[model samples]
Target: MSQNNAIYKGFKVSAKVRQAPDAFPGGDVVHPRFLATVTITQVSTGMGSQRLLPPEIQQFADAPHAAITLALTSAREAIDGMSTFVKAK
Candidate 1:
C-alpha cells in the first residue's frame, strides 16, 4: 500500500448475481456469486486509484440486493483491517 497523498477518498463494493432459467423437472439451484471491490482514490486526480478485491464469494443470498449488502459488509471488514503503507519509489 502506498500513501501517496491520495487523501483516502472512499471505498465501494459491488456484486453480480445470476439465475438459471431452465430446469429439468427439478434441479439444484445455482448459487449466486458475490464479489467485493474496494476503491481508494485521491480527491484531486482520482488517478492511480487502488482497488481492493476480496475473494469471489459463492453466495450472499437468493437475491441481488442481499448479495450486495453482504459484499459491502465484507468490504467494510477489509477496510477496517487495512493499515499498511508503501515506501516512496
Candidate 2:
C-alpha cells in the first residue's frame, strides 16, 4: 500500500532456522532462532483502519517497531495454540 493510505508504520520481523556450531562438545548441532528485522513500512488500512481513520488520521506516522513485533508474536502464538488444540482434538 501507499504511504498516504497507511495508518501506521513499523518494522518487519522474521524467524530463521539454520545450522550452527554447538558450544559443547559432541552435542547436537544446529537450532532454530528468530531474527527480528527492522523494516520500516506503512501499516495498511486493514490493521486498525476503522478506529484510526477520520478523527485519528492525523496521528498516523512512524509507528513503534516494538508494538508491531508484539502483535506479530501474539498472532503467531495464537495460531500455534490453535493448531495444537486442533491436533489434540
Candidate 3:
C-alpha cells in the first residue's frame, strides 16, 4: 500500500487515579484519598512522501501544528463528556 494510504492507526487514552479520598467511618478512616490523571497520546506512522495522500491531504502536510491542535480539541471534547457524566453522580 502507498504510504499515504495508511490510516492513522489511532491514539491512546490513559487515565490514572490522581486523587481519591477514603471514606471515614465513625472515628477511623477506612479508604484513602488519591488524585486522578488522564492523558492522551497520538500514535501514527512517520510521515511519508507527499505523493501518498490525495491532493487534499497534501495541503495539510505542511501544517502539523494545526493538525495537532485539531486532534487535541477533539480529544478534549471527548474527555469533557466523560467528565460531565462522572460529575453528575
Which candidate number has the best TM-score?
A: 1
Q: What is the TM-score of each candidate against the true structure?
A: 0.41, 0.25, 0.28
Q: Write the per-residue lDDT of candidate 3 for residues 1-89, one digit (tens) a residue.
A: 01111122343443333233355555666544343233444443234211121111111111334433443444455534432222222
Best by lDDT: 1
What digit string (tens of lDDT, one per residue) describes model 2 on residues 1-89? 21111122232223222222333376655443222222223234334332211111011113334333544454344333432222222
lDDT of 3: 0.34
Give the runs in model 3 whose Cα sits over 4 Å from its true position: 1-62, 83-89
Superposed model 1: Cα runs more than 4 Å off: 1-9, 20-27, 30-59, 84-89
Clash number by candidate, in order: 1, 1, 14
Model 2: how far residue 73 lies from native, Å: 0.1
Whole-model lDDT, model 2: 0.29
Ranking by lDDT: 1, 3, 2
Extract clashing residue pairs from model 2: 8-43
**lDDT score, candidate 1, position 54:** 47
Give a tens-digit lDDT track for model 1, residues 1-89: 11111123254334444442333347755554333223332233234545454454333455555655665555556656764454567
Model 3 residue 7 distance off true place after TM-score fit, in angstroms: 26
